[model samples]
Target: MTTNQLVEQIKQKKSFLCIGLDVDLNKIPQYLLKEADPIFAFNKAIIDATHHLCVAYKPNTAFYEAYGIKGWQALEKTINYINEKYPEIFTIADAKRGDIGNTSTMYAKAFFEDLAFDSVTVAPYMGKDSVEPFLAFSDKHTIMLALTSNAGAFDFQTKEIDGKEVYKHVLETSKSWKNAQNLMYVVGATKAEYLADIRNIIPDSFLLVPGVGAQGGNLQDVCKYGMNDNVGLLINSSRGIIYASNQDDFAQMAARKAEALQKEMALILG
Candidate 1:
C-alpha cells in the first residue's frame, strides 16, 4: 500500500496499531489442531476478529519458518487471505532479512512479488547495498532496523563512531540510499527517549515500533516523543494481544486487547 493509503487507514480507523501475528503452536488453542491447517486457522480467526481495530498486520516470518514447509504454506495462505479480503490493510513481513544485493533482490521479490506484503523489515548491518535492493520495489516499503527494543541493541546500535552513535549514522546514511522515500525504520518503543534525536534526522519517516504491553514499553511516552504531524508510528503488540486467552474465545479476547490499544491511539490522535 502507498504511504497515503496507510495514513488514510490510520485516520479512518483512528489507529496506527500494527498487530503482530507471531503465532506459536505451543501457545495456541489445542482445539485448532483438529483443523486442516491450524496455523492459518489461528491467523484467520485473529484477522477476522481484530481487523477493524488496527491499521496493519505483521506476521514475523520466523514463526512460519520454524514449522518448515507447513509453516511457509500457512504464511502464504495468511498473506493471500489478507490481500484478497482486506486489501487496504497494510501487511508487513517481519522477516528481518538482509544479504548481498542479488540475494536481497530475491528476498525482496519473495515478500513483495510472491507473498505481496506492503512492507518487510530488514537489517542494515550490511549497509546500503544490502538494503537498497529491497527499496527498489515500487509502492513497497523497506523498514530497516534502527534502535531496536531488545536488550542487545546497545551492544551495537547505540555504540559511538566518529562522535555519533551507530544508529544515528544508520539513520542518516540510509536517507541517501536508492528510493529512500520508500524507507521506513524500526525504532523500539522501549527507547522513546531517543526519538527526539531520531526525528531531527528523519522527521517525516514512519517508524514500526515493537515493544509495548508485553515488553513494558509505555504507550503514552512513545507517542509523546515519537509522534509526528502524520502520527507516524505502527505500535506492535503480539503475544500480549494474540495470547490474551487460549480458549474458544481467543479471537474475541485478542479483539479486546487490540481495541484497547486502538482506543488509546484514538485519544492520542485527537
Candidate 2:
C-alpha cells in the first residue's frame, strides 16, 4: 500500500493501531490445535474479529520460522488472506532482516514480491549497501530499527558517534538513500520522550512502535511526543491483545483490546 493509502486507513478507522500476529501455540486456545493449521486458524479468527479496529497487522517472522514448513505455510496463508480480504489495511512483515547487498535483495523479494507484504522491518547496522536493496521497491516500505524498546538498545543505539547518538545518525543518514521516501522506522514506545528528538530529525516519516500494553509503554506519552500531522505512529500491542485469553472467546477478547486502543487513539487524534 502507498503511504497515502495507509494514512487514509488510519483516518477512516480512527486508529493507527498495528496488531502483532505473533502466534504461539502454547498460548493460543487449545481447541484451535484441532485444525490442520492451528497458527493460521488462530490468526484468521483474530483478523476476522479485530480487522475493523486497527489499520495494520504485523506478524513477527520468528513465530512462523519456529514451526518450520507448516508454520511457513500458515504465514503465507495469513498474508494472502489479508491482501485478498482487506486490501485497504496495511501489512508488515516484522522480519528484522538485513544482510549483504545481494542477500538483502533476495530477502526483499521474498517479503515484498512473493509474500506481498506492504512493509518489512530491517536492521540498518549493515549500512547503505545492505539496506538499500529493500528500499528499492516501489511503494513497499523498509522499516529500519532505530531506538528499540529492549534494554539492550543502549548498547549501541544510544552510544555517541562523534557528537550524536548512533540512532540520530541513522535517521539523518537514511534520508539520503535512494527511494528513501519508502523508508519508515521502528521506534519503541518505551522511549516515548526520546521521540521528541527523533521527530525533529524525521518529522514526516512513519514510526512502527512496539511495546504498549504487555510491555508497559504508555500510549498517550508516545503520541504526545511522536505524533505528526498525519498521526505518524503505528502502536503495536502483541501479547496483551493476542493472548488476552486462551479460551474460545480469544478472538472477541482480542477485538475488545484493539477497540480500546483505537478509542484511545481517536481521542488523541481529536
Candidate 3:
C-alpha cells in the first residue's frame, strides 16, 4: 500500500494499531491443533475478530520459519487470506532480512513479489548496498531496523560513529540512498525517548514500533515522542493480544484486547 493509502486508513479507522500475529503453534488453544493448519486457523480467527479495531497486521516470519515447510505454507495461506479479505489492512512481513546485495534482491523478491507483503522489516547492519535492494521495490516498503527494543541493541546501534550514535548515522545515511522514500523504520517503543531526535531526521517516515504491551512500552510515552503530523507509528502488541487466552474463546479475548488498544489510540489520535 502507498503512504497516502496507509495515512487514509489511519484516519478512517482513527487507529494506527498493528496487531502482531506472532503465532506460536504451541501457545495456541489446544482445540486449534485438531485443525488441518492450526497456525492459520488461529490467525484467521484473530483477524476476523479484530480486523475492525486495527489498521495493520504484522506477521513475524520467524514464528513460521521455525516450524519449517508446513509453517511456511501456513504463513502463505494466512497472508493470502488477509489480502483477499482485508486488503486495506496493511501487511508487514517481519522477516528482519538483510544480506549481501544479490541475496538481498532475492529476499526482496520473495517477500514483495512472491508473498506479496506490503512491507518487510530489514536490517541495515550490512550498509546501503545490503538494504538498497529491498528499498528498490517501488510498490513495497523496506522497514530498516533502528533503535530496537532488545537489550542487546546497545552493543552496536548506540555505538559512536563520527560523534553520532550509529543508529542516527543509519537514519541519516539511508535517506540519501536510491528509492529512500520507500523506507520506513523499526524504532522500538522502548526507545520512545529517542523518537523526537529520530523524527527530526526523517519527519515523514512511518515507524513500525514493537515493544508495547507485553514488553511494557508505554503507549502515551511513545505517542508523545514519536508521533508526527501524519501520526506515523504502527505500535504492535504480540503476546499480550495473541496469547490473551489459551482457551477456546481466544479470538474473542484477543478482540477485546485489541479493542482496548484501539480505543486508547483513538483518544490519542484525537
Question: Which prediction has the highest lDDT against the true structure?
Answer: 1
lDDT (tens digit, per residue) of candidate 3 on 120-141: 9998888999998988899998
Model 1 residue runs over 4 Å out of place are: none
Q: Which residue window of length 10 is worst by lDDT in model 3? A: 22-31
> What TM-score does prediction 1 earn?
0.99
TM agreement with the true structure for every prediction: 0.99, 0.99, 0.99
* Candidate 3: segments with Cα more than 4 A from true spot: none
Per-residue lDDT of candidate 1, residues 1-270 (tens digit): 889989999999999999999999999999999999999999999999999999999999999999999999999999999999999899999999999999999999999999999999999999999998999997899999999999999999999999999999999999998899999999999999999999999999999999998888999999998999888999999999999999999999999999999999999899
Instruction: Estimate the TM-score for candidate 2.
Output: 0.99
Per-candidate Cα lDDT values, in order, are 0.95, 0.95, 0.93
Q: Show how many residue pairs clash in every candidate, following the order shown.
A: 0, 0, 0
Cα-based lDDT at residue 37, candidate 3: 93
Model 1, residue pairs in steric clash: none
Q: For residues 1-270, could you state the per-residue lDDT of candidate 2 as single tens digits?
A: 888988998999999999999999999999999999999999999999999999999999999999999999999999999999988989999999999999999999999999999999999898999999998998799999999999999999999989999999999999999999999999999999999999999999999999999888999899999999988899999998999989989999999998999999999888
